[model samples]
Target: MTTPAGSGSGFGSVSWWGLSPAVDLQAESPPVDPDLQADTEHGTPDLSVLLLGSTDGRHLLRTLARAALWPQRRFQFYVLENNLEAVARHMLIFSLALEDPEKMGLQEKSETFLEMWGNALLRPPVAAFVRAQADRLAHLVPEPDRLAEQLPWLNLGALKFRERDALEAVFRFWAGGEKGPEAFPMSRLWDSRLRHYLGSRYDARRGVSDWDLHMKLHDRGARVIHTREFRRWRDTGVAFELRDSSAYHVPNRTLASRSPPEPSWGAHCSARVLGGHRHGALCGLRHRSGRRKPPADQQRAASQATPLLSPETAGEITLHNVTEVFREITAWWRPRAAQGDPEQVRGDGDGSPEPAGPALESFTVHFLSLGSAQTLHHKSCYKGRFQLLYVACGMVHLLGPELGACVAPGGRLIVELAQYLVDLRQEQLQGFSTKVGELAQTAGFAPHPGAKPSETLARFYKAGDSGSGCMDLTVEPGTPPP
Candidate 1:
């Protein structure tokens, strides 16, 4: 079960666990799409990996090279590039490490790619690093098929290029379907764009950070299976920064159009099974390919799972937002009978302001943890019975659709996002609240007219009758609890 001594070089000398048994090299193949099969013909490895990366700036090529050296070699790669010069650099790296260049068909492709985008390619020093990493990988490729078996889940970061919106959902959809962490590298890799590329100024106000993206992914279902292994790109003397005044554009057309016109054979096999109680709770998760569902057994298991929220329940629940802060929002409950005005107090002779009315008839409040905002949309948990309050701007903007789905006809979603954050550029803050309201409305909540300016708040009511109109949570202006 163990890889012999001297194997898995440059991939950290540590032993990896959970590698599946070696695949039968001579076994009969299962029926697959002819196009996919054709891609594997002519001595190429059976397993395919799609790698998408940028040409310059800091990257994971070293990490990837280390992974390529992992014992087992069944993987064949399709390198796609977001940066115009990425393909050339990756090709150079792969060429140095990979065996049988003419047979692997890399050399010809590298020449073509370099010819097409040579102007934008990496500098000589970075090119030298790729070759060095490739040299390290060359010693590790004992058998390509074994490597393939161990790398089923590699290159998930590549999907970042494809699924820019709803990153959590897209990531969940992919990770949920694929084999577990055993197939990927055991290292925490920072997203490269964080340091070099500044996103829109408007998004900066909405708490859009790369950290938020990682947190969202974690919350949705992708766990980081490894500890951080720090790596930095060697300075090539050329400045990597994208100047604000320069017109920067992503040349994605070639990469985008490369996917086969027909759905690949692997699509059906990788469809994810939504499991446990969450199956019903997160009904918003749909197949990424939109082609097929998981097998019948998975569907049955999901259907039988208990629902998280019941329709007949009449209790209060408090949940935290993405910021992990628990803000107090008051809910009033009264005995069906015997209510002598819960808000009024009898006059006291001492003239001391009558204690704000005795605790309004004993009531129970159910406080749920943060990220309930995500689940609400999945389960239609709020059947328009009462209003929902959201305090975080990130939750409203980043996850509007999920929250909107929870609102039943006649329920209102009250969101409070302060407009005057001094850190944000004035241009970014302009119409910021209005944009948030528009985003919420688009997600399913119908706009309500009573939003006030002082609170920096917006009210969106789910279309329908709650019997009691517009239930607002009375929270004083202040920071939420940690």
Candidate 2:
């Protein structure tokens, strides 16, 4: 499906979400995420999207960076996050985009960005950059005027004052103290947690790390994640295999999340089925709610469907990060266009200010705090407002029956299925599907007719627009949803 790294890498729109066989959903008109390309079309409708808790920067690169830019197409993204850290990280990413291209290339920036995201520890420069942004944001988050003056794209008016204050504290924590080897000292804490989590198995951490990556992640079609990085993150609390820096000892506070407390987690989770091949891959995914195991018959069915990884698997998969996989998503927008002209293009390789191109425009992103409320009755007028409502895999468990109310009649709703979640945590595949379908039905939605779902994803659309919403190309008009 991939050609190679070409000259125009990071200049198109694409995604690794595997939304469908057609690929590059953003490359089409009415892109998944709005790109900042120069527009040739005269009249185009505005795009509004709502996202929950997928902090992958896909909006900026994967979704928005696709296709020809349109001047008339104004894009508004309503980003709903559970906590302050997500907003802070989003701001940090924005800061990276706005950095001077002369000093840091897009590829370098991508590398830095991903590491800062996945890794628990960071390189010296990465740490320094986070600290600098945090120091600035710490001050601005408290003062609305200053924040608007600086980071104009962000709209936090939807957030409560206390939420904003909490976010400021999150930024201050990232900023760290005046002088100390470690400000928050998360590394030690990580080690302690690791030790406790892996009491007897602690000595075999290397093997365990390798097992987790090769078995669980690789099996789930995450070939992009390399063994070395995964193992490193497991062993030393570091995800990215960057040039070693002494600063790696410092824990990345951004990686932390304030999750709703669960009861007696880590009970057991193992992916032991792939079709009929049982790999017996032991995944750390656990039953957090303290739920009981299903009946023997159900578990047997689940096991047959849930495949695990084989410890014997060798051959380290050379990691293909998001950019490598979604080459078009690699292209990024600068925070600020150079003083001379918005059309001026930064030299693809060389730092030469070139002739006029597409006028650089900014999109507004509203960051709102998502509460634990089961229904999304945020506003009375919020009904049928968004074209696309996406629920990230990590947030899928929070899916409510009335969630579809937020999506427009003809719009699409995508929920990333947490792999093997049904097999272990909930009921087997049938039950899981039925539960979700019931919810969607209650909310005036139906399984999207156009979509051909894999083991990984589920797509739906409001009942009004069933006109072949499927992106799958293999099946003509697509198979009927079972």
> Whose lDDT is greatest here?
2
| Residue range 122-241, candidate 2, lDDT tens digits | 777777878888889889888889888877777888888878877877677567653453444556545654554455666876776675556655665554444654455545655455
Clash pairs, model 1 backbone: 72-146, 72-147, 73-144, 73-145, 73-146, 73-147, 74-144, 74-145, 74-148, 410-464
Whole-model lDDT values for every prediction: 0.28, 0.51
Residue-level error in angstroms, candidate 2, position 455: 2.9
* Model 1 vs. true fold: TM: 0.24
Using TM-score as the measure, the top candidate is: 2
Q: Model 1, range 47-151, lDDT digits (tens) per residue?
A: 322112222111122222222222222333333332212232333333333233344333333332222121122333333333343343233223335433433
lDDT of 1: 0.28
lDDT of candidate 2? Answer: 0.51
Q: After superposition, how far is residue 463 of candidate 2 from its true place, in Å?
A: 1.6
Worst 10 residues of 1 by lDDT: 314-323
